[model samples]
Structures are given as C-alpha cells and as structure tokens.
Target: MTTALKLVIFDVDGTLVDSQGDIVAAMAHAFDRAGHPAPAREATLGIVGLSLDAAFPRLAPELPAEMHGAMVEWYKEAYVELRSRAGAAASSPLYPYALETLTALHAQPETLLGVATGKSRRGLDKLFEAHDLGRFFVTSQVADHHPSKPHPAMLRAALAETGVEAHDAVMIGDTTYDRDMALAAGVPFIGVSWGYHDADDLTGAAAILRDFRELPEVLTTIREAAA
Candidate 1:
C-alpha cells in the first residue's frame, strides 16, 4: 500500500532559527525610539509567536493603544536595519542540525514541508534568502495575511495550500502559542526544548524534541501510529 503523505509545518523563530538576539535588540530599539523603556528580555521573548500589534500591547500594556501602530512600524524598521547591518544569517542563525534535518525531510517523497509563522512576509523572505531556504517549503503562511497565532488561521491555510488533511500533518514549534495553535487546528504538535518557551509549558504536544536529528524518527513514529 502507498504511504499517506505527511505535512510538517514549522514555526520560524525559536524553532528553526535562534533569532532571540536580533528580536531583543530590535524590541529595545523600537521602545527607545518610541520614548518608552524597553520591556524585559523575558517579556519580549514570551510573545515571540504573536504579531507586532499583538506583541506590543502585551509587552507594554501601559502604552496608549493609539501608539501601537507606530511602534509596530518602528519595530519593523529597527529589525530591518539590524538585519542589514549584521546580515540576516548572522542576525538569526539556524539552530544546530536545522538545515540538515530540513534537507533530509525535503528529500522524502511522501512528506511535504511548510511554514506557519507569525513573521511578516518581508521578514520571512529575507531569512529564506539569507539561508537559502525558500525551496524547502511547499507552503508558507505569514502573519501579514492571517490573524495572530493560537487562532488556527495560519495552520489552516497551510493545510489548504498543501491539500493536506489535519490528521496527516504535524506542527513543530518551541512555544505554547504553537502548541495551542496546533491543537486548535486539530493537528498533532511537536515541541522543541531549545526555543524561547520553557519545555514544561508545551503541555499538550504529541512529543517534544531535544535535538533536530530526532525529527525524522519522530515523524516516522507519528506516521506509523496513524497508519
């Protein structure tokens, strides 16, 4: 019998890439430019999977609501500047084994890779270009066209774009938002320990990976169980 195709969706920041340095630096720049104190690094990282509008409100609830739009723009400008200065690859390097795992998975005929990220299209494009990762993904969903994560819209779009059923797909991420988003989408979730969120917080994940090298085996196990 032919094996059913599997869709593996990934969250970009924290999961695939270690972008915390640039993220924190950009947040500080935005807050400084906006004449507000920067949020604690922990507070900023806690909102990694959220869109800029959603993130600013959480990070600085004391700021007036009307100022969020400008802050978002400022953050975008700061992030772009940082990427340009440091180069995107240096600003947000991939985690160890990330490229190898992606290459291995992309070689599989019965598997498809995709991205469902809170990152804007422009940001995602820069990362892909810097890392030469654009070819690996079959579907890419960004916050520019969807509601913030934990709302299920991005993953749902990924599924529709790939024509993959929820049952045959899995989400790998490093945050509670990703876990919650996968749950809301009725897809299995795999958490990563190396990302921003504490591993203990990934409450409902089907499995949590400590190393990217373990991913192929985990995917195989999930597929076998479903079969």
Candidate 2:
C-alpha cells in the first residue's frame, strides 16, 4: 500500500514568493533602459513564469536579435536593482505556515528536495542565500538554461539532477504551467491557490492546497500513499 514518491520539486517565484512588485518594476525598467516602452502589468504578469527566451519575445516584440539580447540584459540589470532594493524582503515570504511545513518535510528521511524555477540561477541563488534556505535543495534548475514552465525541461533537469523518476516525484507550483509541467513529466502535482495563476487552472492538479499550512498534511498523505 506504500506510494513510491522520493523527490519533491518546487517552483520559485509565485509559488514560493510574492515577487510581483519587484518583477513588474524591474521588467518596466528593462523596457525603459532598452528605449522601448514598458509593457503593462497584465502583459508582464501573463509572462511571469515563462522562460526568458519565451518571455522576452513577448515582452519586446519586433526587436532585432541584438536588441533582444540587450533587452534581456537590461531586464537582468533592472531585476538585480529590484532585488537589491527589496534586499532581504524580496522573496515571497512563504504563505502562512510554509516554513513550518517545509521543515516538517525536510525532517523525513529518504526525501530529496529540489527547485525548478523560472528565476535565473543568479537570482535564485541570491534569494536562497538571503533566506538561509541554501541547504534545503539538492538540485537547482534556473531559467538560464531551461525551456521554462509548461515545457517541463526545468522539471526534467531537476529530476535528472536528483536521480528521481517521474512516478516517484511530485511538483508543487502556483501556475498552470507548473501543474502542466508536472503532469507532462508523469509526476503528481500540488497546486497552490495563492500564487499568480488562477485557481480554475488547477483543475489538472492532483490536489489543490489552500495555504502552506495544508502542505505538510497533504504531502504526508501522498508520501504515505506512495509508501
């Protein structure tokens, strides 16, 4: 009767942090520095969890290849500025009880934890260090090298890095892209209600969690089922 899940992967931005203000502000700065007008919040929000290659084209349409590179760099610079401004406060503080929940999960033996995020490696690294969460994860797949959410490349990378099979893993995310990636990978998903994606998009999730407080319990059931 034991379920077989052994590894857990999490999406960063909206799933882990409410990085909206900084993201919107920095994206706007990128456009400004590139001399293109800033895209509105709606458009930026729509592109939040996509890979840079995918997101940039959406953010800076019709630009030459060189300009696309420049705009991406511009975005990085602006994001850094934004991250710096938020300093330690930038991370979407885990939804209520998130830390307590993660701590409980980490205490269980044989469980490997990892990150699958749309954030750049540098960005995720900074946030991890700032939050003193650097030790919790074994694998980190950033947007720099992966295809992005809804694509499953990052999720696949994380699984490969951790040496876990899709059937033996679970992905927790806040967007449909994350959930879809999980499904595509043949892994179960735990969709978060408070993240940027709409709840209606959570229809495909294995289960939907209303808050971080529910995480430990939800995961425990999954783990037990897989046991």
Candidate 3:
C-alpha cells in the first residue's frame, strides 16, 4: 500500500533547484579566504542539503573543532556576497517542469505544501520571489533554526507549523541527508534523481521519480493507499 501523505515538504537546494554551481563557487571563495585550499567543486556540491554552518564540518574535516564556527562565519559572509550577485538559481535554472509540478501539487486540496531546506529564510525568499514561487508555500523551514540535513528539525518545524502529523507528511529531496532526515522523522521520502546528489544518495527513499510530472500521480498513489 502506498503511504497516504497529507503534507509534502520539499528540500530546496537539490530538490527544487540545482544549486551546485553557485554553492560550489561560494564555498570555494570561503575556503580560500579561510586559508584552506578549495576542494573540488563537485565535493562542495555534494553537501548542498547542509546549512552553511553544517556544511563547514564536511569540507573542513582537518580544521580544528573550534575553527568550525569561525569557518562557518567566513563562509556565510562570502556566500552571502555571491548570493547577492549571482547564485545557482541564476545560473543552472530549475529542473525541467519543476514549476509546473509545484503548480499541480498546489492545486491538490488534500496536499499541504511547504519547504524544508538548508536555504536561509532571507535567501530562499529572494530566490522564490525572483521566480514568483514564494506564494506557493504556506510556510517554510529555513536553515536558521534547523540543524543541518540528517537532522529532522526543519521537517519537524515545518510540519508543526502546518499542523501535519509525521505519518501524513512526506519529504521530497534529492540528497541522502534529506532522505535520512525523513527516515529519522518517520515520514515517507520521495527521492528526486535529477538533483545535485547522485541516485546512490537517495537509497533510503521510498521511491524515486525521474521527473517532476510524476509527482501528482505519486501523491495520488499515496493518498489512495492511505485511504
């Protein structure tokens, strides 16, 4: 039986947008400014679901534990500057049919939609407003209060704000961190294969979708099973 899901919480970075280029570039600058050699852009891209603060540890494994905070601070400053000028949303563009899929989901009366993303509230606001997609989400869980991916805080908070139960909620994300969080939260996960993380990272997801157009049917299957 497919899980009946009332709420669909999406992770912003890999799930909604292919934010690798901007994120990698920004992190490169941050690492350089911190006097650490920049890692490969692909390496930086792998941590897309993580918060700026959360991403620090992944990239700076050799940095002293105490230096993590300082590194995060510097990264934020550098990334913010990049976000203001040019971000991934500006470069890579949304996955094909991404907006159309969101529109279809929004039209479903039974579907309560929101975001659970590593993006800062301000940053996501800017991106969504630019794309005119901000109004679709009833509420958003930004990186501010939430612990990084693999932590369910963002999903929990978003669900709380929407008054949705974990059993009735599903998290749609493109990375393992995102799926891991959903698994930890006991919510069904919908893995999107087209994002920054490869298919391997989405192993825990209940199912995978090749395209956004498949989502409405997926939701329908879940709802029918839930019924």
**TM-scores of the candidates in the order shown:** 0.98, 0.89, 0.90
Query: Can you tell me which runs of candidate 2 are displaced by over 4 Å?
Result: 1-5, 90-92, 223-227
Compared with the true structure, what per-residue lDDT tens digits does model 2 show for residues 75-192? 7787787677658454345556766766777777777888888888788888888777778888888888977778888878878887789878899988878888888888899998
State, as a TM-score between 0 and 1, how close model 3 is to the true structure.
0.90
Model 1: CA > 4 A from native: none
> Per-residue lDDT tens digits of candidate 3, residues 102-168?
9888887777788888888877887787678887888788888777878988878877788789878
Best by lDDT: 1
Which RMSD values do the candidates have, in order? 0.8, 2.4, 2.9
RMSD of 3: 2.9
Least accurate 10 contiguous residues by lDDT in model 2: 88-97
Poorest 10 consecutive residues by lDDT, candidate 3: 83-92
Query: How do the candidates rank by lDDT, highest first?
Result: 1, 3, 2
lDDT for predicted candidate 3 compared with the true structure: 0.80
Q: Best by TM-score, which number? A: 1
Q: Which runs in model 3 stand beyond 4 Å of their true positions?
A: 1-5, 87-89
Clashing pairs counted in every model:
0, 8, 0
Backbone clash pairs for candidate 1 read: none
RMSD of 1: 0.8
